[model samples]
Target: MNKKRRLALAIGAGVAPLLVVTMPVSSASAHGYISSPPSRQAQCAAGTVECGPIKWEPQSVEGPKGLTSCSGGNSQFADLDDDSKGWKVTPVGSSTSFNWRLTARHATSTWQYFVGGNKIAEFNDNGATPGSTVTHQVNFGGLSGKQKVLAVWNIADTANAFYACVDVNIGG
Candidate 1:
């Protein structure tokens, strides 16, 4: 090839690959954590449910709405996790339900969620109001009849004082 043509080809080959590699692609979920705790009067505190301030990991903030924080109490929410503390399941013919609670003295204080290690939900609580026990429900109608699904609550707004339970319903 001509001298000019050969030089142009060599430079193009090296530069083209670098440009492509540097370009960013869209991902399913963004890497983020709680920037700041949810609004004090927002859903973070449901009907008299006093969850208290969540415990942000300082790293798990930029996640989603409910997440952004982790629970910092010592109840059921403290025992369940994605790796070891598996979820407690209640099966039903048409559907199912699960229930657990958090005391008031655990780890970080905030609210977050994970289904089988994958984040699926989150929440924040001030634990100031008084109400009935917290009840969370999950629908399994989308999965097959026999599937092992785990649910995790990543508390993120209080100290060490809270608990939680997961209820699943399938077929119904």
Candidate 2:
């Protein structure tokens, strides 16, 4: 080969690896999670509860729709489903506000809340993109005492939802 061609080839080979290394990695950025009243994953993220992987990615408890588990059926975040893990309980009235913090807001279909297998409240967004933070007024329906409320964020375009569980003491 010619001298100029050989030098150019050597430089190209060396720079190719560097360019690849410097490229930004595409990862699934975290979505949303219940922030107010401190969901199970929220407690882990805030260091109020000792947990496993969910502590690092509190907003990533994503799984298929219609799931009832706090981990969203994601085994990696199963720590959220452990009721004995001593999650912090926030005291509130019969009606209270639940807040969400979103890292990446997607078009949302509905926001559902449940307690003891019965749905208590739901807010329909009609496939609209939410803001960075969202809030909903939830009524406990005369329910009192310590309760574990499961919150689910249903995505509009996908058959997936994010999950969070908040422990609360109502009318305490």
Candidate 3:
């Protein structure tokens, strides 16, 4: 083989393994995030909410279940837990739809929405894999003013869950 061709082949051979190893991690972390009602992470992803490091990878706010933190208890994206970041909320009414933009869907145990520290809506996937998009109709009766909605996506067969905090100004 020619020297230039041989050198290019060597470079490709060296880079192939690295790309294969990193592919899964990139795909897994690109899974899902709340799209509608614009979660803190979503706003960051869309550049609607100016943030720190989280602006780069908004779909990675995931951690163990039973956590109440908005950033899914993950410190790498701790900016999601900060309310002072000026993340704007999509004004909502008593009932609104939350859309989950799932780039990689997993077998879901359930989806839950919490406001005022209470679950206002939930959906059981029953070990069924979710579609590319999952939407939940959440009702916030008697809820007023500005509120933070903690949305959790429990992955079935795993101890981890994805979290998104969608802030909203309630009206009607």
Count clashes in each candidate, considering only residues at least 3 apart in sequence or on different chains.
74, 0, 0
Query: Ten consecutive residues with minimal summed lDDT in candidate 3?
Result: 22-31
Model 2 ranges with Cα > 4 A deviation: 1-28
| lDDT (tens digit, per residue) of candidate 2 on 6-50 | 999988999887766554221226698999989998899889999
In angstroms, how far off is 57's CA in candidate 3?
2.2
Ranking by TM-score: 2, 3, 1
Residue 15 miss distance in model 2 (angstroms): 17
* TM-score for predicted model 2 compared with the true structure: 0.84
Model 1: how large is the Cα RMSD against the reference?
17.2
What is the descending lDDT order?
Answer: 2, 3, 1
Off by over 4 Å in 3: 1-29
| CA shift of 123, model 1, Å | 4.2
Evaluated against the true structure, the overall lDDT of model 1 is 0.33
Please say which candidate is ahead in lDDT: 1 or 2.
Answer: 2
Residue range 1-172, candidate 3, lDDT tens digits: 9999999998899988888778646755566999888889888878987777676666778799888999887777888988998988678888899999987788999999898789888899899998899888888888998899999999998899999999998892
